[model samples]
Target: MEKLELTPPPAILFALEPLRAMADYVASLAPASQPLPQGDGHPVIVFPGLGVSGYATEGLRERLKELNYEVHDWEQGVNQWPDTEFDGFLDLLSEQLKRIHSQNGRPISLIGWSLGGVYARELAKTHPKLVRQAITLATPFADQPNSTHAGWLFTLLNGGVSPMDEALLRRLSIDPAVPCTSVYSPSDGVVGWAGCVGTESEYHRNIEVDNVSHWGMLHNPEVLRVVARLLAEHRRGTFRTLLDTCVTKLL
Candidate 1:
């Protein structure tokens, strides 16, 4: 019998300077995780990763709601679903965000997983006024043209033929002014570790965790803690408590 080989997600090999910068930024922010008056009843739109369905993340969504966040799912089916084109993907996101604003009179927050993170960033950029903040889990901004193996396969699986080049990276990289948080692990089972790092810039924080696979991270308690912290800080204007917790854990 032939044994199957599991190719680990691409690792991030480099000095820790950039990661330290990200960590410091997160720590510097004040800690406050409370519901915002703006969010009143506005729903949070969640974008799941490739081949991931809402059912799989129901627990997480419910958990957030329990924390007082109104959670909404795209329900676009898993990565295996055939008709998932990029343009159509964007259209759906635009409509959903608009709908949330219309129904709740407030901007919505986006929590994107894997490839879905890319969409979340784009939506925030296009509708900055309507998107309060974006949380990307294990997403990347690879040199578009030289993106890692998984990115290429992802493109093939989804529709679209734009080469991963500097242009694409520049276009997709979230603006510095937009509040965005990227949660990633060096040991992810898919996507290169480098892709997870947020470029040295303002209002962008990258968090690196240990022992989380690309898929497993969606449910990792630590990751959830980080997400809850980020979202709460954004809506409530306090982040020091959580930052202190993370600092204590690191120490």
Candidate 2:
């Protein structure tokens, strides 16, 4: 496989994040007046992106809660890259997943944002029986980690460690054993959009939303609508590609 370098978005486009966030916030409000599919009270865990706490995902978690899902935040404080071979952070996350699964008496759904999505996919692969499904927002697991705008920051935080170490990158490219959805935007300012595509499988899908910034994903109404519909389909025991769902909506 050819090595891919980080392809950051244009500075001008990246700079529009704040404005896009505001627009998304305004658009998100409109979803309240529209009918949304109700959730089935299944447990869903929301993971924050790198260097952020649960606060980063509060809007999304609240929306999922409003839709009647039992949602939990990954309260593990700021998510730092693992420093040890054992990966204590992932171990802690694993324990949390098992705890949540045992407590709910059912498999849990995982929603990861950016780096958190990478974690979600790995967790599902390791603990498939404990995961109902995995959903990722702008996660770049399919490409070299340096292909993200945050790559420099990640390297700095990890004592100049490279995330593209052969073994780790290979693992990231493998498909998880559970149903997966990757929500990505071609205009994402932080990570290369091509890096976010999930492995194609009978249970995996890649959904593209136009003109949304990476930061705005949490508040984007269109993204939320897609999530809501997917949750509803999961609840109904129906498996449909996002393309199929979009076609149904057009009809």
For TM-score, the strongest prediction is 2
lDDT, candidate 1, 1-251, per-residue tens:
12222233445522333454345335424353433222244468787776667776676687678778788986566743236555666787698789878988776778888777887888887787888778788876432423444555666664655344456667776442467777888766566667667653445666787766666656666677777666655442233344455435443
lDDT at 45, model 2: 92
For model 1, state the Cα shift of residue 227 in Å. 0.5
Number of residue pairs clashing in candidate 2, backbone atoms closer than 3 angstroms, sequence gap of 3 or more or interchain:
1
Native-to-model Cα distance after best TM-score fit, residue 10 in candidate 1, in Å: 5.5
User: Lowest-lDDT window of 10 residues in candidate 1?
Assistant: 1-10
Q: After superposition, how far is residue 3 of candidate 2 from its true place, in Å?
A: 11
| Candidate 2 lDDT for residue 250 | 28
The residue-level lDDT of candidate 2 at 181 comes to 86
Model 2 per-residue lDDT tens digits across residues 51-121: 88899999899989999999999878887766655356678789989998888888888999988898889
Which residue pairs overlap in candidate 2's backbone? 6-147
